[model samples]
Target chain A: MSQNLPLPPIALPGQPLAQSPPYAAGPGTYTTQNPTRTVITASVAGIPRVHADKSVSVTRPSPSHPLLLLPEVASTVLARVTRLNPRQATVEIFAIQGGGDGIHGGGDGGCVCEHTFQGVIRAQDVRATEKDRIKMLESFRVGDVVRAVVISLGDQSNYYLSTASNSLGVVVAHSDAGDPLHPINWRQMACARTGIVEERKVAKPI
Target chain B: MTDRRRINGPLEGTIPPVFLTSSTHKSIIKRSPTTLRKIFLKTGLTPPATGSAFLELPTPSTHSTPTLKLTSSVYGPRPLPSSTTFSSNARLTAELKFSPFSTPGRRRGYIRDGVERDLSAQLSIALGKSVAVGKYPKSAIDVFVSVLDCEGGLGDAGDEAGGGVDVGLMSVLATAISCASAAIADAGIECFDLVAGGVAGLVLEQGGVVEEDRVEKSLEVGQDSDDARRGMRKNGKVTLVLDPSPIDGYIILAAAAVGYMAARDELTLVWTKGSMGWDGDSTDEVERIVDGAITASTGVRLVINEAVKERLLLGLKEMGLIRGKAVSGDGDAAMS
Candidate 1:
């Protein structure tokens, strides 16, 4: 067996960052066509394309492809859990990078999204045994870049997402001085500007 | 990939270019306009004061028998655009339609498909070089082509009963641009040249094909091994046909780069013979058949003119566009 192995990641149809299957990466332009099959055609000059219209900023799907026709998925997120009351939990999330669905498809639900999450905490996860579990109330704070997983379709009217897993935690932090912080141990970092103790993720083990 | 040629034509069975700078193909319809049973004039079916024409050809009734016919209409010359090349010339528009039932199966897709796009692009290129596009800058002269009827039999020999859109073939040049030119003339667009086009192909027997090696690679840091284990391979060779038939492929096209309707040619060289899961290794038999097919298809240029064009124009005008004027004294009899 290979040593130091972790979970397997599926390689997308583009150039691989680390390593990927040779066949998956073709030697040509990867159109929004079938992300699977690569197609090539003549390059006619001066042909007007409909996608050039920017007022709508719509990324129309390829006429042949149906999958990408909808909005794109969110990638990186930043937010914090606040006021995790037993009966009701209110977690306010913020967007460091807005990875909303592409091509005019936005919102988790009908309601416009802002910095907040309000929902019922799972009854089963109400136990305050583990540190991150009990501290789920104080486990998060302002200015913390925490990772999240979509617990449910958050957008009853808006998009729903949560970062309640162990592997899913904060990645970066700033001290009172608003300077970069360095990490030494898990869940903790030393602010370079003020030397204050800050909490962030040690980074995913893999 | 280079394709092997085989002997084709309704007389014999089985199938599937002469290119110097690049390869080009033409489809040879058995009987063209000249050999057609009756002679037809522009004013026979429609008045000269109006636009367009359409025509029909006869076919065998039974056994592997299929029919071929052509129709066309013309429109044009309202204004001009400086952005175009033919500031003093005219613009032409063209379209081709293949009925769903025209072939073995139902055609699919609402948007223009790859093949359709290629055909459209080719038609535009072939006609653009001939028409005074810049003459009516910003304005277009449109021509539409539709395959009204296609039978099982093929003009190219190698074609089987079940393939292509209609499992039938067309006179590449005549069918491609016949309706196109008529539509222009119907629209009254003026230009220096009239583009003509056709299709013809070399036939080849299916031979043997060999597979290549497997490639290996690692997955992403957190990627699953199952994706690789599931087994995936390349899409395999792309099937190509030069002036393909119904079974092999059907391509009707044309061009006019010289006169008001002169000859401007285009070239294509992709060999799609064996991509239909019939690749061959030894090149001898394939070579012989292809040679014969090319030799026989040589007369396509003349065939398109005599067979497909004039007839289609008359028909289009008869059915949709204005009718032809009577031949001199036949006005009363012709109208009846």
Candidate 2:
């Protein structure tokens, strides 16, 4: 399918890839408008490919590509809760979901970032319903790994995160006895070994 | 006062032996004014850094000139420090340093000196323009370059006649700019273009009179006769040389270094030093020197393009995307 597209074996930064009329700019490429026409140029050194949808992109080699991922607004992330307070839970963002494919489309699994960024999930954003009745301790613990969506780029210190959806909450947790907990429902998790139940904002099984 | 912590050398010192024939003080190599020294550039040398590169200019056959060696590492697109004010675009910072033993005769200090700081600022400005900073908001990119070995002496002591221009430092700065740009590109940072640095200088031949043989050779090489004549009349037979080296022994009158983007036809940074006249009548002279620097930059850009492509090709080959023959074929293309 990509045979008909005029592709260079490799592309360097600022190398013009194609014109905008036939192909739209994709990842690793940007468009610039001149007096005569718009040109799509490669922004990184990689192999340029033209997608089936008439979009051109320069894809770096797979191994080093994950290092370039960053957490952006409205994107789902996998974060490990590092600290908890009365009003909020601080998390360290470890992986980004859907990679660079919008919010819902999955592109080659998720990209695991090389560096973790600071994020905070406020008490009110723990769930979609009953915002005022939520407790930070019961919803998330310091060691829990939570699935969250970035709501906004908060203050200088942390990225504002939300786990308000049924699918966006604590995906992993441990009981008081330190046994791994399995989700029994949206709000509770039961330990398989200790038979102890803990209250958490649990994510529904996929 | 003398230190008491360690044993010192004997108080009575003996005179060191002196060689009858010293080969180190030989004359410098001679080349055409338009020719530049060959550069060897490679990227991805430091595995720990996000991206790294090494650049070198080999010592001439005479071995009088020291090899110019530089290493640059790039970090980030990572988060900024919390204490800093918020910004909408990515901030780029560059730091250039010389290793203690990189220079001859004297050891450099651990702390950054005024020259290092000045070069760092210039390097930042050169690289900042090529990067698409808007793509990475609220983050910072840091580039660090260390002069592993240096060409030309690192100090201003060498060019006492040049007044303000330090030829050795200018060459080092130019090399550092190119090295940092390669590292940035290797890091996969989004950039509008790759910036290559070049240096050109107006040199005054030792004697006031222009030799008959030299002028005839320059004319035969198709160099502008008017420029040669004008410089002779105005500034004691000044000659413009691309990629001027301090080891050449020529007394430099002025020098210009530029960070040029070949594809975009833009110059990101322009630094000129020395005694170039700033008066209205000397504007053409300044333009001519800058134009010579630009031409030199275009030559360096070709080497950078090949270095980047070589790394990418290796990556593709390792992934089994191309066969061995194709890899060799591409390498041949680059050489040609």
Candidate 3:
């Protein structure tokens, strides 16, 4: 019965690894303490990894595995504009880009999200210049995909988003004639099939 | 109230009652009264659910041991109802139901009963402590538990004296807590820890005799109304048993059960039945009982971790990242 067997690196939620001063908590890890010691435990099911700085973290075995990702302040997100009101444009956030790599993990299931986070683009956060005269309907359509940065974890129901930078704004949309449109300017897009120009706060393409 | 399409029970014959009594049926395997029945737990069985698990506590003697079997499913961290006002924390809900044929007595109704409702509330409270609710604000997580088989009836412990322990309810709650935590983990819900539950009771000895030796005497005393009962009330000694079956001869002076987070050394839920006296001197007795229950939960926590790790290994094997020939039952080795 004595065979050399290596331990699997997997860590389940709530599993404790080591006491904290020597091991700082990283992503997928959270710290808790008793009267005597501070302990680090995995918050998600994944493989436990120790970094060079003695900080410990857990990472999913596969990148494609489904996991719920919450939108944090200053994180870039991909969202579809759902509707518009006088003060803000309502959007549903579907994909979150990581802070370091900018790698996107869209909603858990491919093309279908079990849970979609709500976000909002306020008139003031839409562009850097126009804080007073920005109209929600003119800047974003019902089905436009917008690249935005989360400004704040807004009210209970939504995250506040901003697209004020030159690189952020409408990434995809359709013209009134029902054709794909490309950005023609910072404020407009043109349909290739009909050559019809439409008003939008367009983003710079990479 | 009158739906002709619904099937009804027979109206003619008088049915027998099924109580949680000591079994007369002889078991093939002989075990000490203190040993817990072996537990078998597996996760990810229900494909449609976000996560699911099945649990079985089987004894060697098929007919004599009261079998406990259950399954739990977790559905979401999805959007909340639109009609509700905004909530900053994730809402957690649990529902527990017994199948119609799970028990030996009358079939259960489709609607939830008071017992089921109470257990559901307790389950939700126990699980809510471990989940990272603040992370998924404005969303809700739903857990549904179904008892496929059970050994006792609803009124089994209700009519008993204060010194009596509700073994059936304790077992059901303990199993539900363990199973639901696995399903939540399988669903990939972020949690600070997985909670494991266990039950323990204080065995009160009489005179110079040990509690186990007094089973026959206590049974005979139960037949006599007043004198015998009063005579047996004096306390001599008390010992705690981690997992006590109904047949255990101990007169349970106090019983306690808890949902324990082993890694963090915290308790999410603590349920107590019977009194450990109201006097200040009895504080140590109560603490001792609670500590015993926590130790039992650690044993259960080990088993829960093994089941979860087994699933993780299978997933790794599927990706060709790990070898497939590793033995699955190497329990203690994997844990250490």
Best by DockQ: 2
Docking class of 3: acceptable
For candidate 1, lDDT tens digit of each residue in B292-324?
Answer: 223222233343344323433333334332334
* lDDT per residue (tens digit) for residues B129-197 in model 3: 999888777788899999987754433534342235556677788889999998887777878999888
State the lDDT of candidate 3 residue by residue for A1-206, as single tens digits.
Answer: 21232213678887777679877877677888769999888887766666566767665543224555666677788899998898989999887764422111232222235567888999999999967999987899999999899888777678899999998999999988789999899999999999989999898998
Q: What is the lDDT of residue B323 in candidate 2?
A: 47
Q: Model 1, residue B38: what's the lDDT?
A: 25
What DockQ do the predictions score, one after another? 0.01, 0.53, 0.39
Q: Which regions of candidate 3 deviate over 4 angstroms?
A: A1-8, A34-37, A52-54, A62-65, A100-113, B1-30, B59-66, B154-163, B203-239, B247-253, B275-285, B321-336
Candidate 2 Cα outliers beyond 4 Å, as residue runs? A99-106, B1-27, B59-65, B158-165, B205-236, B277-280, B321-336
lDDT of 3 at B5: 94
lDDT of 1 at B183: 39
Order of the predicted models by DockQ, top scorer first: 2, 3, 1
Supply fnat for every model shown: 0.00, 0.59, 0.52
Name the candidate that leads on TM-score.
2
Ranking by TM-score: 2, 3, 1
The CAPRI category of model 1 is incorrect
Extract clashing residue pairs from model 2: none
Residue B243 miss distance in model 3 (angstroms): 2.0
